[model samples]
Target: MAEAPTDPSHPAAFWDARYAEPGYAYGEEPNAWLVRQSERLPTEGAALVPAAGEGRDAVWLAQRGLRVTAVDLSREGLAKTGRLAASRAVEVETVHADLQDWTWPVEGVDVVALSFVHASPLFRAEMHRRAAGALAPGGLLVIEGFHVGQLVYREVSGGPPRADMLFTADLLREDFAGLEVVELEEAETVLREGIYHDGPAHVVHGVFRKA
Candidate 1:
């Protein structure tokens, strides 16, 4: 992946430019892995989605009858999310903010879902902590993204080119330390979402439940 800009406003500016391009960066559908794990998700509850680019995952959650909140740094991306929600006849609350600096809710949501948010290691750890803390009792957190092994396929993996941003099963277990690991694994798979993630890939998929 490209390096996030260093200037304070550059991250948003950069993402705005990216999302401002022609089509959805990833796609307009929920992640395939998330779809497979949907049975564990509550049909009606509040969900928080961080780094919800173009709101596909967030919009999908809303379609499932959940009140969903999607937070992202790019205003343009959120705008697209709103349009997508309108197109789907669903509602997704879009929040424009930087995850690195935002205060994550504690015990306030029934689900927290993150997909392919490849931030720098420190911010990534913080986001994981926020995700774990956001869950209410018996709440679930679903995260799926590129495995560290994807570095080998950087040319076509569609993951961050940086190894620190990529993940391993152990990394996730450590990041979400307090949650109960309902399922955690890493494997090879094919991603056929959009122009962004379209190829064979190595990935990690996990579901953690709060007690």
Candidate 2:
């Protein structure tokens, strides 16, 4: 059996190697929720996608006529995203930076999209704050990730192992205190990734609008 890749010490390197393969790590399409919510997103506004692995979401947003800036620590991932954007004939700004240390834009982004970005609790809180602070008034923030119950399915440990790393509706509500909670729910979904996440999983999806 292949060993699970869960080393938090060098996530950039791990993900970089994982994405160095021939194709996208999570497929070429965008997340289902993002596609469904595209109508709600502003057509000509800037979007920030932090920890944007392989840039699927960012590229999709760009294709929808949104100016997108995607940041990821992994060079390999950013390269793949750039290639995808070029192939799709969409423009996107790609940045290679670690979210924990990189400076985020202040009060300009119309949307901040975080999809399946797992981090330490402290870092996660900081990320949430940065994402919230980067948004302009009435801007939208979309987040989707696994919840605690996700550990029960498939036994395929791919996400953050610490339960604290998993998100809940209450946690999001608390972290993004001033945002209007447009939608929040816990649901079960199947991730159809290549060799990594391919099974049933419990997750929390949220959409918040800055007040």
Candidate 2, 1-211: lDDT as tens digits: 1224467888887888888877787778887777768778988889999999899999999998889999999999999999999999998899999999999998899999998888788788888999999999989999988888876763662566668888888888888897899999888887765455667778889899998
Q: Runs in model 1 with CA error above 4 Å?
A: 1-9
lDDT of each: 0.87, 0.85
Pick by lDDT: which candidate is best? 1
Candidate 1 lDDT over 1-211, as tens digits, reads 3233334437788778878988887889999988988788889989999999899999999999999999999999999999999999999999998888888899999999999887887678887888899999999999999999987665664777677778999999999999999999999998877776777889999999999
Task: Give lDDT: candidate 2, residue 188.
Answer: 87
Cα lDDT over the full model 1: 0.87
* Position 14, candidate 2: lDDT: 83
Q: How many residue pairs of model 1 clash at the backbone?
A: 2
Clashes of each: 2, 0
